[model samples]
Target chain A: MATSVEQPQTLIYVLGVTVIFLASALIGIMYLAQIDISQEYTLYNIQYSSTVSRMVNSPTCFALEESFELPEGYGTETQVQAGIIDWWKFNSGITKVCSDGRIIYAYLSSLDGTLQKQLLTGRDPLTALSDSDLESIDNWNTKQEKYYVLVYKDSQLIPAILEVRIKG
Target chain B: MKKAGGAFLTELLLATVLVLIIAAGFFGIQHIPGFSLEPEAKALIQSVGDNEICNVNLLNLIRSPNEDGTLGDTLITSYLTKDYTVFNETTTNILNQVMLRRWVMNLSINNRVEATFGDPAGFVAVPCIAYVPLPQPFFSNCSFSEIQTGFDGYEINFTTPDGNVTMEIVNQFVTDSDKIGGFGVYPTSEWTTIPETAIIGEPTTINDTLNADLLILQIYVGDESEEVLIPYELTISEPSEDPDGLTEVHLTKKDLVQQCSIALNLFVELNNE
Candidate 1:
């Protein structure tokens, strides 16, 4: 009777050990899975950032006017031929080639706060953007992306911002 | 006691075997070819190609002659010999070429460096570099032929040391009903409102001795008075590789125009002189 009782106790102890081992293994696996997910996220973020950078720096942004022919007397005396921008064509070009699911805004402005020309897609044009809107756009929260680049407009390097909201 | 010990040992062995099998499978997934790194590699290659194009565009801008009558370091007014030297140095250094065996620039009155540069009708300027990697091949072997039909523009055929590489730069001019005449002095031809195609460069073929890695830049100065379209096509063949599967990179007329516009704008902005 004593041996039978001891056998039951030993079997129970073995079962308890196996349960503990399995639980630890599961926890270990979960930890590893979390690490892998984190790493993949980081890699994806890097790739996304690079793609956005390339888009911003693309030559299409600074495309010149179809023709640089000046009006008869415009630059005759100075002979200074400043490159002109075909704003409408450029806007369309960027829209067609830009990655989908992202809102893009391009603006040419003077050094002062005056807006010259603004191109917006995927959002309504606000006559004036409030500070809060700018904040939300810049912060990018979780699913959105924002990038700003400067292109030379004549002698001035004008700032152009591209904001994208990632899609599922 | 012996029976219990054997049972315990067997359980331990089975658990160990299971663990090993799982670990092996987990690590084995990474070794499969083209699984993890192909996307990254493709992205890198594309980035490199774009960078190369940008570099080449900048070099072209630097070599272009300034429009003003005053001659700074502009290549247009300089002696043809000096122009050749500058081209050689720039191409060799910027392109990282082993040697620029041959170089040529064909210019017309419309696209000449400046008004004073003179109208060189059918003039082909060849560089004076002495470095010839191979004996000059016969020009007939690499002459420009109308191999394919339906293309309204000019085509040039050349054989690189590696193999045959064909490059064609075409510009189609569409009449703008709103505007009369063409850009500058060249007006649209009266026949069918279709502007006559202007071929600026000479038909020079690359000597087969030249390096396989070649850089070709086709600048299409379109007629601004009307809508101008430029289409550029390049086909490259690796002699060592299968000729049947030729690699070609085509930039549609629209994209080519955009590239030219962007390049010109950037060139103007970056011009220090």
Candidate 2:
């Protein structure tokens, strides 16, 4: 009779543990809700500065998009005249393209999957990122700041990330 | 007692999680991307604005009637133009094509910097357009509602109370790519140089900035070159607005920097890396 009573109590303990795990996971998702979406890019076919000048003289991109689900719809990949929009759309931040299209990802400092109502901030990253070394990791301050990293493989955008906190 | 302690700990964890969520909502997301501007970039943007201001001042040098009827000695003599005729628009376009034909006009290093901005004809006071609506028969199959001119890109005209007023820009161009190294001119008596205080330099490059001559233009090509006009006498068109509708009439330096930074940054990122 004691053993039978103990089994019911243990079952209740397991149920409580499962509920706690789900709640904790939900909280984390909510905390890191926003994705600083950037572009997955490839090198331009033309000369650098000229491309930049011509891009500035061109019209603004005619469309906007919002999605986090798979096969995420970024705009049609076309060459622009090397401007701010190009920078954001072609950032190879976190999730990268693999040889066979499988994604090899890294941790980005951001809240995962929780934002709704994404706004058009229209902030340009290049105006701030003038001289930062692209290939280094130390430039990132995981505590005070984080880089919103965009990743690309085979010249395609995958998931991006931003470091929210660094554990010492 | 042990069970009560576990439940208490669980409650504490939940509270912590709630705090994290709220903090992220308020502060965390915005700072990540928007605050990335470097000090150098800010300085460069400011220089670009400075250049645009200098350019606008040059336009004010000619004696032109203000929005009021009073005369002001601005670089632009007047915004008043005759209503554009189809033929006049065609001729002006052809002239602009010739005027804009890129070539190196030479100068000695000591030549005075000569710069001006606006519709070329407005400064020159050339009467080019006259009102003549499409005569009698309209072409059934055509896209030519109005005769288009090359200078149209440089001009933006809108109607105001006294009469129709138009504004335009005249860009200085270095035509020959090869001779750019020693390309220059010695100031002649005809070239008018603006004061040192007013100079439109390249926004970012120290090398590009100078008390260089007020930039000038020459129509080495067509008869109608200096005669292009855009009249705002009609009431259909709406006035242009800034990116944010918070203001009227002027596009602030902050606005251009916002535009240029976004454009050039994207260009560099996409084209180079």
Q: Tell me the whole-model lDDT of each prediction, alpha carbons only.
A: 0.35, 0.26
- Best by the lDDT measure: 1
Error of 2 at B206 (Å): 50
- For B1-273, candidate 2 gives per-residue lDDT tens digits of 465456556655665566556556555545675343343333343333222222221121111122332122111122112222332332233223222121111111112212212233212111111111111123111111221111212443322222233334233222222222233321111112311211122122112212221222211111133442211111111112221111112211111122111010000001001
RMSD of 2: 27.5
Model 2: residue B217 alpha-carbon error in angstroms: 43
Report the poorest 10 consecutive residues by lDDT, candidate 1 chain A.
A76-85
Candidate 1 C-alpha lDDT tens digits along A1-168: 568546855775677568657855775576456433245444544545544444544434433323354554354332211222333434443454554445544444432334354444544443544566556556654333322223344444343333333322
Q: Which stretch of 10 consecutive residues in model 1 chain B shows the poorest summed lDDT?
A: B264-273
Model number with the top DockQ: 1
Error of 1 at B25 (Å): 7.3
Candidate 1: where are CA atoms >4 Å away? A1-63, A68-103, A107-126, A139-168, B1-273
Q: Is the docking of candidate 1 incorrect, acceptable, medium or high quality?
A: incorrect
Q: Tell me how many clashing residue pairs each candidate has.
A: 0, 51
